[model samples]
Target: MAVSFVQRRFMSNALQKWAYNLSGFNKLGLMRDDCLYENDDVKEALRRLPQTVVDERNYRLIRAVQLSIQKDILPKEQWTKLEEDVMYLQPFLKEVKKEREEREAWNKQY
Candidate 1:
C-alpha cells in the first residue's frame, strides 16, 4: 500500500530526532558545546538528513512531530518551518524514484 505524505512527514521527523541522539558520541569528538535539541541549527540540520540514517526511535519522533503539526501542537510558524524542510526534499525524492524505476525496467529485460 502507498504511504501518504503525512505518514512520510511523521517518519522523517522521528528519524531526525533519533539520528540526533545517536550522534551524541560523534558530537563529543567534534567538540561542539551546543546541545543538540536546544540548537535550532542542529535540529534543522537533522531534519534535512538523508533517510538512510533514520532509525526506529527517530522515526517515532518524526511521527509525533507530524501529529503535532496536523493537530496544531506547535505554533503555526514552527509548523511552517517543518513544511519548508519537507518541501525541499520533494524534488530529490522524485528523482530517486524515477531512477529506481529505470533500473528495475532494465533488469527485467535480462
Candidate 2:
C-alpha cells in the first residue's frame, strides 16, 4: 500500500526518535513532532542512526517490497526497478542535510 502523508510523517518521526534514543542525543521536545519537514532535525537524527540500524531499515523496506511482489501487490517487472534507487538513501539524507542548512541560514537572515 502507498504510504499516506500521515503514515510517512509517523515513520519519519519514529525513525528520528529511534535514532536520537540510540545516539543519546538529549534535545528537549525533539521527539514529539510528527513533521519531517524540519530538515535539520531529520538530518541530525538520520546521522545518528547506527550504520547497522540504517542497513537493517533498508533491508526491511526492501523485504517489504519483495513481499508485496510475492503477494502480487506489485508487478514482478518492477521488482528490480528500485534497486538503483535504493542506493539513493545516502544521497537523500545528504540532500536533507543541505536543505536543513539552507533553512537554518534563511532563518538566520530574517
Output candidate 1 Cα RMSD.
Answer: 16.0
| TM-score of every model versus the real structure | 0.31, 0.30
TM-score of 2: 0.30
Those runs of model 2 whose alpha carbons end farther than 4 Å from true positions after fitting are: 1-44, 72-110
Estimate candidate 2's RMSD in Å.
15.9
Candidate 2 lDDT over residue span 21-108, tens digit each: 4532122111112223546556566676679856765564565556656663334343332122233245556776687889999999
Give the candidate number with the greatest TM-score: 1
**Which 10 consecutive positions of candidate 1 have the poorest summed lDDT?**
26-35
Alpha-carbon lDDT of model 2: 0.51
